[model samples]
Target: MLRALRSVRSGLHATYLESYFISQCDKLSSKWLTRGLHSAPAEDVAEDAGVTAAVGARSGERPNKSNRNQEVRPFTSIPGPKPLPLLGNKLFFTTIGGYPMERYWESVQRIYEKYGPVVKVERFSGSLDMVIAFRPEDTRKMFQAEGIYPMRPGLGILTHYRSKRPQWFSSPGLVPGNGPEWRRLRSVIHPLLRREVINAYRPAQTEVANDLVRAIAASNQHNTKQDPSRHIISDTLSILFHYTLEAVGVVSLGMRLGCLASTSANCQAQSIIKANIEVLNVLGESMLQPPLYKLFPTRGYRRLSAAQDTICRQVDVEVARRREELALDPEGFTQRHPFLASLMNNPDLSSQDVFLLLIETLQGGIDATATTLGFCLYFLAGHPAVQDKLLKEVQHVQPEIHTLQGLPYLRAVVQETLRLRPSAAARSRVIQEDTIISGYCVPAGTFVVSPPNVACYDPQIFPGA
Candidate 1:
């Protein structure tokens, strides 16, 4: 619901994260005017709603009275850093000491500045030819071209891994695949967005959060006894990771991971955290690199594979346990575990499908959500006045923060945080048909990368930027 929430220098774990953060609709003082919080004029809100609606539809643009041939420029006409020989634009990425994938959106932003709104990236080793579109109107139009199914074509490293291990990921599950199959798998998740569904998980979520606070208190209490000053110093991120993994475990796998319970650093939960981060980190790097892994198990591929294996094994074990229990009790199991139950009962899915899909939601979702929430807490920590207001509002909301009933500012804070420093920096989709972007004709099947960060940071789009 309102995730990516962190900032418990005192262990603001879980929705103990939930119990703390509050959403208020009142306009924050001049302090938040810069971030353009809830105080925005109605026109801006209306415009944003339009964009959100279009994006939500997830359908592509239809031909607007022969707009396809209305003097639209060729796809090659778009400007970007020039490619050279066989290496092509691979020079900008893949090479040692080249652009790191960790700051990929930065690279895209620079290209946006140098190449204007529509930038074409050509001839990267394993990547489809890409067009980086920056303008908002173009963004709206591009999504319109998405037609019935939006195709996002660049998870080469992941597709490669799952391809190798056909046993686990029979058809790449959902994350890296597209078309009818992807749409069907994705459909099963839509019901999860319902308020009733989220409400059902509230008690368990609260427990996980309380456990997070307990874990933090326990660790800091131990360290402080060793040295009174140790209380002042804490690996906040590490503790947050424990909470996030455990929280994710409750929702995704319908169980507590006991990450907070594990005192050992080499615990399975700790390993999953480590391996999960690596998978994301290296996957970003490999996406822009040469397709060496295609021919053989390159070092990056091997590393990704190993990390995936670690995550997959855990999922496999859980799936087997669930399956056995499911056999013994079907309806009871479904009532107890909504997430796993949905997957377990899907006629379209296999045991492997259940495991792989859980891997995405459990491990991958955990890393991104935790980091985002960490940023949110960091922002609140810097602005004490904002924190004070939030505390007052939080108390006002009392036990209803999850519904976000009275928490508009809290929602604004998250929105602004995501705009400023999002975990998923780049949003992309492969065009399913010929599309018009910034007056240029982008061919169907072209990889389109939209850097929302660039747009988010645009002074024109964001009032304060």
Candidate 2:
């Protein structure tokens, strides 16, 4: 989840931060496994513009001015939610749950309102302290001044876990990687995201999406029988998640998880889905609280370890089966398992590295895609005129679920949904240079961040982008 997840500084809010996790180049802007999931809101994955921009930011447009000699005030001058003695903003953030964007955004809104645009959030009185710059101009400056190896303080718990087990992870397998090793792992994903790869795997995406439709239909039948007027599918989010998991599995795991079965979803499939939920919840917990587990194995750390172990074991079982299928028909493997085939066949990457990438992407992509789809449905339902236009488009392209093009209205609706409801409140980057952010000359190593919810709704900012 490297460059791909970074919301664009150029107009559109690309959904970043906790709302949107992981920024891998392969999670294609528009051309991902979730593409045909209701013909959802997607960036142009084949174009891979974000990947190129990310790589360029790291390789070409950097080695930025390290103004060690500049006449700037000390970094401590930057203001944020004040910290207590030996305990920074821990008390303030303990109540800030990372999910449900509005809840987290509410806290951020208060901070922005109190501290103006740029506020230094002193979390636990350590280097973990962050400076949030709330303007688009400031955000663009951070990216421009970000050095070659722009370091993001990704999941600290995840990085710590991987450090303890270097045998299984190659520089944390892109989730928390940095420098050359991070680039090496990221390189393999770039080649596999071409139009041919996306085109080859459209069947799998379409197949799972169709299964979702069937699941919805099946549920509607049961619901209509129970109460004639209650025709809607109960637990819509759960069904959507099943579809997203199966859709992502097509690429991430290179096999079906039976998540969208005609009858009941199998036990193993349900467990995998549950395991992912556990991982996301733990991640949110780690962010809310301090990382004391970094020093020794805390109970929370144990929970994270167990969840990660479950995902790893499950992925290995599926990967081993895929390898067997590949050995039987080597030539057909490329067409059948485009992404996996590339990863497994690569000499530079280890087997462990490949599994880590797939599992990470699977964990990273599913919930966000499903949630976005859900929001798209909610907004469409509320506005029948817009919904009717989209229905007409879907009908024109329907009968054949794979013919996804020519639906400008669907694309427009998805784009609008993401703009209105992004994946995360904000994304963070540690500035490597002494840069001016929101008029303050923020020194090197300060985290230049953004206020997530404020930017999207403010008419004066985007002016209906």
Worst 10-residue lDDT window, candidate 1: 22-31
How far does residue 412 in candidate 1 sit from its true spot (Å)?
A: 1.4
Error of 1 at 270 (Å): 0.7
Candidate 2 stretches greater than 4 Å from native = 1-79, 96-102, 123-125, 164-167, 221-230, 262-265, 398-405
Error of 1 at 369 (Å): 0.6
Q: Which candidate is the best by lDDT?
A: 1
Could you give candidate 1's per-residue lDDT for residues 411-438 as a string of tens digits? Answer: 6676677677655555578777666676
For all predicted structures, in order, the TM-scores are: 0.81, 0.79
Residue lDDT tens for model 2, 342-424: 88888887877887788777887777877776766666656767777666556534323333235456556666666667666
Clash count of each predicted structure: 18, 17
Question: What is candidate 1's CA lDDT for residue 55?
Answer: 31
